[model samples]
Target: MLRGIVEQEGISKEKLEARQAQIQEEASKRFFESASQKASSLETMTLKSPALKSRRRVLDDYDSIALERILGTSDLFPISYLQIGLNAGQSICRIQIRDARGRSLGYGTGFLVADNILMTNNHVLDSLETALDSIAEFNYQDDENFMPCPTHTFRLDPEQFFITDKDLDFTLVAVKDNPSSEKQPTDFGHLQLIPTAGKILEGEYVSIIQHPKGGPKSVTVRENKVSSIFDDFIHYLTDTEPGSSGSPVFNDQWVVVALHHSGVPDPNKKNAWVGNEGIRISAISTYISENYVSYSATEQRILTKVFPNLKPGPSSSSQADGYDKSFLGSNYIVELPKLSEEMENDVSRMEDNNYVLDYTHFSIVMCRSRCLAYFTAVNIDGNQAVNIKRSGDSWKFDPRIPESVQYGNDLYAKNDLDRGHLVRRLDPVWGDKAQQANDDTFVFTNSSPQHKNLNQKIWLDLENYIMQNAINHNLKVTVFTGPVFRSDDMVYRGKFRIPAEFWKVAVMVRDDGKISATAYLQTQKNMIDNLEFAYGEYKTYQVPVTSIEDITGLDFGNLYLHDPIKDRETIGHVIVAPEHIKL
Candidate 1:
């Protein structure tokens, strides 16, 4: 295959030979430099060591023993190394490359690079059509008792994301979501490809996890020595077969170093292999970053997940002065809702008498008495929205407010309660400041304690529907969300009050230039009990904007006039599906 690629590219034999020699020399220089650094460090350590004042034994073998102590004879690894390697091997899968008719074309190896994203050789999955037709079979190996393990198959979703480079011989595509599968793709954790160098040094051993000859998953453990290094490729003396094309070449720490693609044939002999070559992970990352502009927002978002280092961090100049009223445009101005005099007295305010707390793309007005946001407002630009993956739940307290007032992890630590985001994490995530906007949503000020069942089901679905609506129409939307605080709300943990009902109001300008405001209400009143969530049916409703204002004692200016359901006699319409949504 290497010869075939060389011939197809019309590369002269002389050029290949010269390139090989240059890479070999570079590898040798790197190895020597590394060795010199190690020796220098050892010498410094010896000079700093305390002198042995009382040496009782002075034997002939003492000098050799001391030398051995300074310079280690063998490489040592921890007992956990095997366990880590085994865990990493689970991500490896056999790729069954087939045609549209389900006829087998061939087979190769691939692995999860991110959640629902697989990485393989470009030659194995050359085009979008090829990837779409292929399927990834996980757990395609024998069990501990040498019995065949049940495999989980997942189809590739090239329509969602697909990128490849013929020169790099690498392809990255998304795997279709398989919620009903016995094992999820996320169950076998991904091998994050770090863009930085120094993962492995020259002359170090690399392990290849592969499915050789279209067979069960196998690993050649630390047997391949890196022989040469180039700008975009590395040569290793690794034993691999035809079906090992897309195997992940890993270092001792189970970090992926390269993507094994083809073998380097022995020049002196025919039908013999000298070493295997892999595309450097760093090179692939660089290529993707450089060509990021060509991809769609969805693809770019996925790329950012696969290469998090490429995602831009929050800018130092990013100053948020609360949600913008004119974010929808000059013609359509949606001012902040006015707080009633009685509600205003209980609202948390700064020294300047400003109640709105500024974040990246959102603002919050906390209720001083309830210790929860009276309302949170966010500006959503659907076109520029970046889908930043949630790293973890790290709810924090806003430093501007007293920590004693805001609820932390205590309320949701042991119960079925969820710290639901008032301003959804993905709402304000757009433009160059997406990551910062995402981080800003994690503050405790923006969260409300709700039943897990309510937060994860209809409420989440409604949020997705709203976002998708904005995206589909290529419009900007301003959203206001908060709990419907009532005097009779259930009290939990002796001090904190858990609101049973949550409401969201979204305002957007239609393509026809008319402003549209819609309100939604979800209740968990029956679900929340004394200290736990009892089984109960949770319902979401499309309500009139006037109803929200009446319940919360807040004036939303002229938003009620633009309500899609305001003219209707119904106060609340049950939203069972996406079609049930008014706007």
Candidate 2:
């Protein structure tokens, strides 16, 4: 199958030889370095072994010992080895690759590397579409009585999490949970890929569990020997067929050492195989660590679960600090919006009477009764802004607050509602701490349940226009955003009320050093009420800061004076475009 792929790709023999030579050179370098380290350890042990034991005296007579007794225990393994190997085998699965129409492409081996995460060769499930079409079949082998065991199939969810490297020949993708199945992926524990070296030495016996030729599960236990070690790969003498790609190469203790990927052809003989090569687990771990920050919030969360040590530094918000009221600048002071006297007790607050949940460059004030934020405030430094891409969504509850007081995935699951970011993700994502700010926006405290169309269209456009205006002019802007909670708001799932109207107040300093504050309101009430309908349109209107305060029961202090629409006799000015904004 590998040969067929190579032929189809039109890879020349010269190219293969050059790649082989490069691998060999790297292997040789790694071998010598490892050899030196082993020699040093051996020397130290040789020097210390004698001192640790008593001095040997010349024996007058030697007891006769049977050769069978010595040989019997020399290479013997403990009874637990079989049990450990059997448990590890459960994680191994046959990957059935298929096209869009469900036609069989081929098969490869894969194993669970983390909860709901499967590891396989990139060639087997190369792209997101391929993974979507493929399925992981567990317990595809016969039982002890030679009868076929019931198999469980799971679909790959690359949309949730997927990271692959072609050169490394490894791919990690999320597997959809199958709770109704007789056997769950969690039943078979995952193999943690340790990054440290010294799991096995060259010439040591290794083992491989694979689905060869897409056949039943099989194990070549302790028959394969590690022949060479490289910085990123290892060559081992093993009986691996085409379908063995992505198999886990294990040490005697069942610890995964490498990911089996390809075979090395015998140079002197035609159509003959010498040994197989695998990407070292340590190398894969290094690759993941280096590129972790580039992944989306969902990917990062999954990776952090797999590798706990890879979690980023603690969030600045976790320290109980509030928003920097003077973040815009010392000269331009924009204080935090104040809640009305009757609404003050409805918010969560600290011992200092501060009701803000501070993050990297933003803050939030949670509404206890609504289980969502009353408002979010952020300081945007357009000059220092970073162009971070939105890959995936993974919202988490803030640890400082009670989880019960937060509306999480349950509120938006299996619905058209979207978890809208109150403080736009890209707004606070600026300066040196951009990534932290990006992650900070994913908390449930900073999100509200919004209709899909409203969140994706005009509402989103208005946010982009405001943010882009600040960036284009290199101006610093402080924005306050929140949902307008109403007593008549619709109760969702009988748990919490979903806000129909949302509002934003953007404050910026003009060239003349005068403060310019603008307020806008958008409602998805029609969409929320008519969710069964295929389509519903939302309206966005520019309003006075005082008007927003009246509905939200919040005081913007002197921001009302800076509002350009404060003197308008009418309530709202319907905005159709950027030119329609009353700045």
Best by TM-score: 2
Looking at model 2, residue 136 earns an lDDT score of 97
Error of 2 at 135 (Å): 1.5
How would you encode candidate 1's per-residue C-alpha lDDT over 223-316 as one tens digit per residue?
A: 8567666668777888988789899998766778899887655556876776777888878887775554334335556777888777332222
- Give per-model CA RMSD: 12.4, 11.2
Expressed as tens digits, the lDDT of each residue in 86-109 for candidate 2 is 999999999998777787767889
Over all chains combined, what TM-score does candidate 2 have? 0.53
Task: Give me the overall lDDT of model 1.
Answer: 0.77
